[model samples]
Target: MSRTAEEIGRTELGPRPLPPLGEQRVASDLSTVDTVLSNGLRVIAVHQPAVPMVELRLKIPFAGTDPMHAARAEVLAATLLTGTDRRDRIAVDTELALVGSDLDATVDPERLSISGNALASGFDTVLDVLADALTGAAHRAEEVNRERDRLVERITVARSQPGTIAREALQRHRYGDHPFTREMPQASDVATVTADEVRALHRASVLPRGSVLVVVGDIDLDRALAQIESAMAGWSAEASAVELPALPEVVGGDLLLVPRPGAVQSQLRMSAQAIPRTDPRYPALQLANLAFGGFFSSRLVENIREAKGYTYHARSSLEFTPSGATLLLDTDTASAVTAGALLEIRYELGRLGLAPPNESEVDTVRQYAIGSLLIATSSQTGLASQLAALAPLGLGVDWLTEHPARLAAVTTEEIAEAALEFFAPARFTGVIVGDADQLSALRGLGGVLMP
Candidate 1:
């Protein structure tokens, strides 16, 4: 019998129904933890037994950009996994491969972090290897030179990219004379760093006292603590606070425009200093900023990108850190509309303060902020990093658990207050990367050009 037309039509396309707007299951609630090791290592163990894999993060107040005297700490941290007293670099990597584990180490501006994941049963082995590398690894001169050259290459490449250039410019503008202005070392500087400098930084910074070990997986608190203690027996260094200057209050009204010549699009960035992570107002500020430009449906996106189609992407963020908070607003658009875009951004900032968002806008934005936080922490690494980042700042364990309630209860007045407190429409440090002629048009918008 010949196939009927209805049969063919039925098979070709099923009934078309609209997909749901968002996710069905909210993320699992944050892992509750409380404990501190005898050696003063803050241990927050989130026992997720369902997964056979475990993640560990050891964070010390040591980073490459943090020291003016030397790059030793950074070099040591970077080379931690490269080799050790018991194992050569090749042997260490081979061991990791055999265990089906991954190891990564890096030195940020304020923290030196070592993170890894391995099978729960292989935890002790991994920890032992990591401790060995941390305690007795040699910073070979050849390796240091190689890494220096590599970093210089990376920086050179970054400077060529418009986005990186904009970010670098933004950091310089926001920080001015502060240590925050100093970025990762360049090749020349890295090459000049002696091996002794790296050793000194390691001895001073990456020690048991200044570090926190966060372990999450199948291990119980007791096992986790014992394993870590056994592994880190030889690791001991003096407790020292990370030397950091209080971030300078962003002086409103300084506009810096970095002109990128012969460019089709202009990168726009506006940032100002705000509250620190421990500030009580931070939770409210986070939610308010979400409504302003922190999310896709935010006022900045709705006004500039969605409504006017000025650019492809636009977002803003309230950066919470140990040092302090920064309100960062950024976007990229054609040079013709660059000035208009900044104006719209400025208007958006002012609007948030001038008028409270309607109930629906407020609720929608609040749900998003809370929901996004829950979802982001679902990963072991994500959760570990979040806690590690917060621990040194003294943000309590309940910060995540109490976040939803705080976000839900945020008032319109508080939202407006946070907007006023953080976003300075009049005092914006501006950066634009485009052709010199394209930048001339921004002069009327009030900014100084740098050659």
Candidate 2:
């Protein structure tokens, strides 16, 4: 007589402990070539033969002190590549479609960035189009007017958003009169931008002397270099790119309250000074941040979201600027729980500093840190974007390859020290935006600056 199927399943398929993870081997065999063009454009090309596509990134330092610069630059980025000397908008779009390529341009207070990807065989076509836009972008009057109107409308909508209001208020409180506050230009300023003003900003700020170009894909190094040189030969500028002044460190003090009438929810934002990636203690700090509030399993999320149901999400991260870095923590919660949430957040910050992570906590976050870094760089597009982000800091492939080792080498003592230094509650200051009636209870919490 054969045994029943249920009897065999219970006897042979009992639960058992899973095996440990095996050793992981990260790929470090990428062949890279670096060159500086005669006109001072630095190019870095990495050979990645797994796929038949090439990723391109171009970064131009576009900083200006003029109050109207941000609005003008915003318009310039929108209209850039709309039309060039050799191709109108339609022809440009048609050619890019033929080569299976799409490019986009964006501007921030730091730089103007262009990123795209194309078929490996169509690399030359991509470079030519890029060169043409750099040299001959027409900034036609009609396109400029249309884009300006659209930009004004978009800005109006964004300003009405809770997130936008919180971010703008934070910047103003943090930087005072610094140029970084120009990140969110006033709608009035954008409405006044003329086509001629955009053209002038482009002529003055789009030079190549301080720019970087990064390409990653399946291609021969020598041939790619030759193609880039030939395609960009006609693009040159006598002036170097503008450089902004260094940012001042954030001053920590009482929290500032921004009134939002009838708001059902409140946005809680906080910031503290942080060290740059180049700092020796950064690896330990990164792991410490993960254990505190930088990941899903962090103490902040476990306490505020899961335990108390104060919010659906809570996160902390480091933002690296050209001159410095800042640690930011943000979450939104119901108005009824805003004061309680802020009190708990302060408690967690103080706890992290007083009683740092234990050995088990440190080990878990260290593994996550290393694993996430390796996973992010496993694809062509991912590697290209990472390289481009690091280029402004003068970092390259070597930095990316060696960072995992650094993360692994961080000790528990170092993490404890980093927590003590950076996670203290007195080291942070920020703004809270909510309805006055809803946040009247916050005044009793102490250290709130009312507007």
Candidate 3:
């Protein structure tokens, strides 16, 4: 059935009414057990019941200052579960297979994380295996050598990437030689890490004190807590895990030009200070960030990508670091257009602070913020990961459940104020990674430091 042309023509044609936003559904006040054990590990257990499986995240404060710490930490993560006094690699893999479970470990500048999932009934086996490795990992020489080779290959490849180069430049430009700046260790450093060094680092830094373990799934909260306590009983030390030293504040100034000769493209990365999720004003700032560049509909994307075709993508978001929350904006463009892109980016930043978002824009971003959080915490793994991230910041399920209401209560005026104070162009500094020869136009634009 189709309307006649005359009938269609007679109807007033205007924008269709935007659909009403769906109800902002937040997580229920589920029963949770959050407490510290005798060994000083904070354990948080919750029941999601979405499936008969459990998700686990163990985070240990693994920060260090030794120049070689990053290399040894990487090797330790790679070979942590390969063998222990009680079991070898083959036996560990066999038991895990029988339990329908898998485990993986990784390290960054701040912590060592071991993440795993298993069928609810087989969760005990998973924990037992984790306990075995925590107490008795051998860090066998062969296993160490194998993992070290892989790290070398990955490091070599990563160092050659433009994104990695830009990240290193921005990190150094902001934090200097801080341990937090070493997101990736140098390949040369990794090659020298011996099994003995990894074993030593493990003994010194893998203590359960100040660490956290999170479990979410279909299980009795009490039973899960008991099991974690029993499994992690042997993993303790008198000394607490080392925490990273606080980072210096990021101050605003001229952008550094990091020259990469003959490069066909350039990367621009910028940062400014921002409030955390725990702050009362954070809800408003979240919406302001989205309206600025956090989504496809943001002002930054609309101007630089949709209208001017300066870059393929542009993004801005809040990043939580050990120091505190910071706002990061990034984009890449052809070398010839890098200067123009930076100019437009700065113009949009100034406009965001001066003009701010109107009510309609604020409403759209509010809906987005609410919906995204709901989606992020909808599944067991999602909730587990969220809890893991928030635990370090002293936030938990209450914060998760009450966030929607906070987002709903922020007004357009609050959004305007947040935008004005936090999005000012003068409050940022960063680095530009590109061929210096193609970036002369940036000299006239004026916040850029010519190479």
User: lDDT values of the candidates?
Assistant: 0.73, 0.89, 0.92
- Report the poorest 10 consecutive residues by lDDT, candidate 2: 8-17
For each candidate, how many residue pairs have backbone atoms clashing (under 3 Å)?
4, 0, 0
lDDT of 1 by residue, 268-352 (tens): 8887777775678987788777888888888899999888889999998876645687778889999888878877887888888
Instruction: Identify the leading candidate in terms of lDDT.
Output: 3
Candidate 1 backbone collisions, by pair: 72-197, 72-198, 253-427, 260-434
Model 2 / residue 336 / CA error / Å: 1.0
Task: List, residue by residue over 22-52, the lDDT tens digit for candidate 3.
Answer: 5877878688988999999999899989999
Q: RMSD in angstroms, all models? A: 4.1, 2.6, 2.6
Better of 1 and 3 by TM-score: 3
